[model samples]
Target: MTVENEIELTAISGRRSTFEGDPRPGDTLPSMKDSPAVEAGSTMTMTPGLEASRDQLQLQENEEHSIEVLPPVDGGRQAWLFLLGATYMEMLIWGLPFSIGILHVYWTNTLFEGEGASAITLAATLQTGLLYMSCAFFGPMFAALPRWTKTLQVAGLVIGSASVIASAFVTKPWHLIVTIGIFYPMSCACYFPCATLLFEWWHASRGFASGMMYAGTGAGGTIFPFLMQGLLQRFGYKAAMVSLGVGYVVTGLVALIPIKRRIPLSRYDQDGISRIRPRIDWAFSKRKALYLGIMVIGMTSLGNFVPSLWLPSYVDDLGLNKPNGVALVAILNAATALGNGLLGWLSDRMSLRSTILISCVGSAAACAFLWGFGKNSGVLVTFAIIFGLLGPSFSAVWSKIIHLVSKDDPAVTALTFSIFAFVRGVGNMSSGPISESLLKYDTMRGVIGAYGYKNYGILLIYTSITILTGGAAGLFFNKIRDV
Candidate 1:
């Protein structure tokens, strides 16, 4: 008999049915709805075989219910709206932090004159680090309490806005750390996890959708630098910070309206008595592929923020006017936006490892060649655009990373993403101290060419090497599949 016929026979023999008609190949199978119901509140007992059959029927029903309830993936009004909301969230959560280069320029010249680069860079680093690190905690929190997502997001919006507003009143550098670094990132931990909701809404086009969402960061970074620069020039940093905070509150509230969970909380708690337990995938922690991927992510992350935090200052060091520096930062951000979308689309079409390899190798080349030797505004601008395009947008590969780490198991994807985020966070946090040490001493001075003799030679070489190592991890992609 054919496989289909065999399955039909097996199913028929497994269940004792009330139907009198002999089942045909194409006939609809008997459903539990046709079976006699246990009276309300009456305990029903059955043989072990019967109990197993009933449990199987219930599981099949639940699976069918889930399919029917989920919105169509990659399209439909609700799905697109959710994407739009997520994009806006990305803008507010990441835009300000990415544009810290402009603030670094302003503060060094005025508020924190004579302060070392490490102190200023620390706040920005903390902001970036917390944004990534918090994912480890918040990812699990959301998984455990999916119903509270909207509430937590709303709270985050308020806290983040307040933190920015508070930064306006800061009189010292540490104040900026508390407001911008600590409070803002704390709020981000709440808001950023909402991006995972897109997984529920889009599957086929998830990479594309995530790319579009992260493009918001690029959008924000592009516009905010210009905006903050203009604001600081005209109204001063105090007014500029306050205005951004107010703007975040107004815009964030509107964006939150469309954001929501795909599946209802009740669906996961069918009996209304089962406690919602956190599903921790400890086995994922033991996988060699996981560690290799983390190392790759960590290495790339070490240099990811170098340009964003220092490029504007580097422009100043080169004697470029403030406007030129601002413009360079804007160009970098615009290129980043393009890169995120393009790489995301590429991941959907090609092997994710290939896309990651391209980003790392290209970024390394830009840093070692274009950025290291850059001497004038023209070279700096070219470096910014190219490096932004190839380097900083590695976050776009996250969806692919999650897919690989989870081995295509949807249930563990979020936790895997969280773990990767934590690893990247550690790398980001360390980059601040690492950059400090690199810039503190100039061993290459007078020994190498003018480019290497330049103060930032150590920083550039370090960035390039780390990025190359990250790219080398791609060699093991085939091994990951074997695992």
Candidate 2:
């Protein structure tokens, strides 16, 4: 039969039903294949060639549920309120590190007598390394924690807060490292899963929500420096640490009460089989997840912690005192938060790639132009502002990943995110050391050039270049279509 004739035949054949009740004279037949037929209360006529059309409609519905594209999900008021809690908690969590530059200087000047800039640099790097690396371990763990996510989040907040507060009373490098790096991140890891789950609930608004939550880091970065400086001036480092830590603990506890996973469902085929596999399917390994991993690793490795870890130190090197240095850090973080919101909004409306590209390029230019030849306080402040605003705007990266990937395939989503975390973790691990080395290079006055290039400034130039390359990666990413 011709295709059209076959379609007609199929439609007619599909309508041949065995009804539970007697059919009325005018009652249209139903398809046995499409579940059992009802009585004369309602009737569905089988139109010619509609077999194909019905199949197409069913498939479209299934795809819509699976793909998470088009109009987005049906999140209600509760979901948005949850997002707000997340935004505040995350801001508190992320902001602490952004303000660490001030702490680093404070530690070097007071707590660690004779501890040079390099030692301080290493400490900040380790803090960053722990924070980023924890995400990789926590991402998958968070995904698997069907229960206990909240428990862990609460525990993390408590520990992080207590640790920070307690650390103020200690006077050793290992003490700070153990408290800030290991303990603090361990607590933060509790929220990672909750954050990703938020995306599942708010798929349509995921980019915007993600940006808001991530922007908390920038906001924290912006506010905490000034706060810390003020507290330090008023009550000394120990008192300030206790106050900040207590605030984090209290904020986290309050915020976490409402942060919860939404409705749950089975991942099963209609044939009554679960999608969960007995073992890892090695076959799926050679796919898009791997490429995404490489991209994340390279991009993150380039300049992940420059703003959070190095910017304040660099500012201090430019002849600024403590408060002024802290102010510079605040500017960068505030700017970053602004960038996150602006760029995130644009990503949903425009091409995500284009937004990220612009962000990366802007960061690069700020680093090279503003920081490279920055002579006076004006130039330094300007560089910090521009860099703070534009540098970490790359927060769009995760949002773009979610947009490109299919949410229905949780395995793929989980794997891709795992890889992203892994790469970014590695980058976070190295960024501190790399940045320190660059600073060291810049400090070796009259070695690289006769003009005595400012090592910190030159390193900032390198960071800018690395960030610019990430932009290139985003642009090139457009070519690979089938993820």
Candidate 3:
């Protein structure tokens, strides 16, 4: 073969050349001894087939990892259904607790052998206090136990069931206090936080969802009282307790079965980190403190629940008797449920602060004008219906607090809830005592005095002041963006 032909053949064959010494001047070709590879930058190129194969592998890995870490989104249908189940469970749990009043009266009569209203009210007060106090640990515990959400829910069902069942067997106040007050709260604490996770799954409907959640408390109040009253009248406290406990356990289990973690376990720690540590926001920044202070005043003064517990007794004093009084309690709860639901929806549509202000003012007016000076049964009934309809408007207060802090700030939200709960707890603790003190005294003229108020008329005046204060504070709460 010719030299040029041989050189062309070598180039086409992709053979390397090497040389023992450096190339001579003007020599472009590399010797056989010197050559082992192609020119610079050539090594970086890949065949099109290999490039496509690598891309396919990367895409498969991405899809696999995504499926492993995240939950499948299904146009939010399954999520909404799960929310429904959660809502039902929340209603049942909260309702059962709120309905303890009738049981309180019956238990006092049957076991304590006491007819004093003050003694019976202590059970409710203690139950509320314990529930609120449990808030302190619930946030932290929930943050740490994201992996075991459903487990905590089941435990809540067990605790709630056992509390009432055990209370039925108690013969003393302490027994009632320990089981109903302490154990029930501890269990609820476990479940309430988990139940709130539904919020993460549904943002657009959160306000409506929250309203429905609270309305369950009202529904519980409505149902429990009537049920307990009837049961006590017929089968008595022990049988009633057994039946209620069984019902709670069954309902709780059913509701809990549908309660699931909307987010996959792998997605919980968002920053590619494993093992989430509990973080508490202790800063109590000026904004948080201002919001918290307003809540405290709202909880203690206007937003307090003194009248809700005592209104039935007041009806009795006004000659409404037991049946009508119980019915009135149902009416109040119905109103509360309706009001809370409506106002919550409105708050989301309009302004949360406005809803709060309007609710507080309406409640105050109802107390002062309708309830305070009602002349007869017709007037009193009118007051009861009106009050029930408007009184629960303030239920939007919680949504307001949540809005006042950003959704991403879980630590702050948890702390805010704790503070809110603690303050509200103090109000609940004092409500019975304060309302009782005012209504307990009877003057020669048949005027009743309570909480240093000389008459029921005066007691209404004081509550009006509180309600007004709450309204004013609520008005001052501007809508904090991005909170």
lDDT of each: 0.72, 0.62, 0.59
Whose lDDT is higher: candidate 2's or candidate 3's? 2
Q: Count the backbone clashes (under 3 Å) in each candidate.
A: 0, 5, 16
Models sorted by lDDT, best on top: 1, 2, 3
- Candidate 1 C-alpha lDDT tens digits along 1-483: 111121221212222111112333344433333122211222223333333455665654553221122344578898899888888888888888877877877777888888755666677778878888988887777767765777888888888899999988877888778888888886765455555666666666777888888888889888887788789999988899899999988999899888875543332233755444444566777777777778889889888877766676677777777447678878888888888888888878878678888899998888888878777777777888888887877878787777666654323666777788888889888877788788878678764432454468888888888888988886677666632
Off by over 4 Å in 2: 1-75, 115-123, 265-285, 307-310, 320-323, 403-415, 440-452
Clashes of 3: 16
Model 1 ranges off by over 4 Å: 1-69, 105-121, 266-275, 407-411, 446-450
Model 2 pairs in collision: 91-216, 156-187, 332-388, 335-389, 442-455
Q: What is the descending TM-score order?
A: 1, 3, 2
TM-score to true structure, per model: 0.80, 0.74, 0.77
- 2 or 3: which has the higher TM-score? 3
Query: Which pairs in model 1 have colliding backbones?
Result: none
